[model samples]
Target: MALRRLSTLLALTFALGAVAGAVGARTAPRMWADQLVNVTTDDLRWAKTRVRVNVDHWDPGAQTGLHRHPGPTVIYVLDGEVEEVFPDGKTVRLRAGQGVWNPARTSHNVRNVTSEPARVLAVHLDPG
Candidate 1:
């Protein structure tokens, strides 16, 4: 009976450790991204383009460093609010139901200015 109790205690300890690890991983800072749509335009012979759509979730105060896309991108705010900074030092705030367009190869940075979580959907029209 004593040996059986020891075995049970060991199993419980292992299980608790696994659960704690999982919880910690979930709480870690990370960006959650989901690709919602992908399509390639075949009708245009000289200007064929690939379109990709994504939904991105940002943690509070998270920011995407300055980056540029291969093509124009349209971003719509889905929840909370975010600020977009252009290379010219201009900034704009977009909240839910509002969107903005960025020209191809436009350098910009997106940052979540809210104290709560935020989400946005982006549509990319890529030529390549």
Candidate 2:
């Protein structure tokens, strides 16, 4: 029940942010985040994974340096527009409220394309 409530809250927050971006509202330029979960201690006999949520405010004309993820990642575009670029020059554009799923071991880069900063929430689940 607690998890349900948290999920509902996140959904509402994302919805409002998306609507604000679509309307070009002033509220669309920033990012808001929830705390990280998966605080289990690591055990040698098993694999424990950590979960983290990252809210990013990507400045205009800004791009993320190349990075790697050893785990699966899920990201939501809360406001404005951003592009996820691959090493081969492929790009996936995310608009307000769009969600993306990245497989484990994926490597990529990102850039914000709009005049205003882009807001995004990244949920990462560590690999076993």
lDDT for each candidate structure: 0.65, 0.64
**Clashing residue pair totals per candidate (backbone < 3 A):** 0, 0
Model 2: lDDT equals 0.64
TM-score of 1: 0.66
> Which portions of model 1 miss their true places by more than 4 Å?
1-29, 32-47
Question: Alpha carbon lDDT of residue 32, candidate 2?
Answer: 26
Clashes in candidate 1: how many?
Answer: 0
lDDT of 1: 0.65
TM per candidate comes to 0.66, 0.64
Error of 1 at 39 (Å): 11
| Candidate 1 positional error at 10, Å | 57
